[model samples]
Target: MTFRLSVERLVRIFPAQGGAAEPTRAVDGVDFVATAGEITALVGPSGCGKSTLLAMIAGLEPCDSGAVRAGAVTVTALSAEKSALWRRAHVGFLFQDAGLVDRMRVIDNVMLPMIYRNAKPRDRRAAAIAALERLGLGNMIERRVDGLSGGERRRVGFARILADPRPLLICDEPSAGLDADNTEEIRKLLQIARADGACIILATHDPELVTVADKVLPMRRGQLVAPDLALRAGAQQAAAAS
Candidate 1:
């Protein structure tokens, strides 16, 4: 299988801000591969550097050492402008916040990224609407983003990323602030994305987020730890019982 994203001994360090100690290693020689059409969950406690690792893969932050490859492209060697372009073309990022424009309508927000790519206006709008429909938000196209509920806003963000049609999707705390029903909806959406050949890397603390994951990597103290088989078996049994 072709790997959609690969991290080889990736390392990132943050310099001390206000006369603190030496540079801290946020990510320390972690390695993983995300294959196309699969969901990889990164789960751990807070301050485990999950978000930092995702940002480095997204080219939003620089790595201190090692390499990140999205398909055949080397992210570490790309210039800032080239990295931005590469991300725009091949990566989609969903943060904890929806990050929508309050003044824009739901569909418009979804179409904005396509606009930056110079896609045809009519085609962009059509694609946005289709994406929203896939997310079960078809009827809310004309509504202002500010008026939507938390779940609805998240669906809109999911639609926006889907409309971008990127191969690699990175989600940070996608289940944050979502109730059970909304969480399931997001989970279903992610499953659909995986079916459509997108490689997903999800960084989240929620145990519910791991239910559908193909592989789970637990991060702790800047290292990627293996998932506990006993815990996983217990979780599977509980899920079956439920």
Candidate 2:
């Protein structure tokens, strides 16, 4: 099933820490709609609130204001107690840090999400093996994680996304630290997922991946930056560097 994610004037502010008077506004009046079959790339510098916005969209954090509508479900309003169940129902998240369990085998890590949702052992095992194979880690499924590189570990982390049957795919820095070949594979995987009618919203700084985005939402200091201006500026810089 296809899913549409709508964010309307979303706002989340953090209280000042270490005695500063001004509270940090992590997400400020953000608004955008991510629909099925398209990849929306949130492009920006490291400190920008792109990750924060994604957290709200994934229902991993609370927004002080606004609403997140995924299909018929309102994401932002879900209580903390139900966050896991809600996420399991509608979202598949690939954490920025490649959130895989270091001590577990690749197959075990991939099946963890389904286990959290109480999926039957037989079913989750099959799904986990399938996800591993699709991401080119089929042989590594039984191998100890100590044998994998950082990029390979990240691929194992992403395998979790495929095991869970969710329509909206959220990835943060999906290609970070990957080799050129692995990065290309990640891009191809994103395209394949999009073709299968999943709505994808990812935060990325890779120019090659940016070129593939159907829409680029540039951001700075908790606000949306104008796309045309950013693109023109990038073009001028590229021209100057060449």
Task: Provide the overall lDDT of each model, using Cα atoms, as 2-decimal numbers.
Answer: 0.87, 0.86
Write one digit per residue (lDDT tens) for candidate 1, span 1-242. 56578899999989887898877778999999889999999887778899999899999999889999988899988999999999888888886677799999998899988988999998998899988998788999999999999878888888899887788999988888778877887888899899999999999878888988999888876788667753565577689999
Best by TM-score: 2
Backbone clashes for every candidate come to 0, 0
List the candidate 2 regions with Cα displacement exceeding 4 Å: 19-21, 144-147, 231-242
Return model 1's CA RMSD, one decimal.
4.9
Candidate 1 matches the true fold with a TM-score of: 0.86
**How well is each residue in 1-242 modelled by candidate 2, as lDDT tens digits?**
45788999999999999999999988889989989999999998787798899989999988999999988888888888676688887788898878877788888889988888889999999999988888889889998676788888889878889777578899998888998887888898899888988899999998878877899999877888798877776788689999
TM-score versus the correct structure, for each prediction: 0.86, 0.89
How does residue 171 of candidate 2 score in lDDT?
91
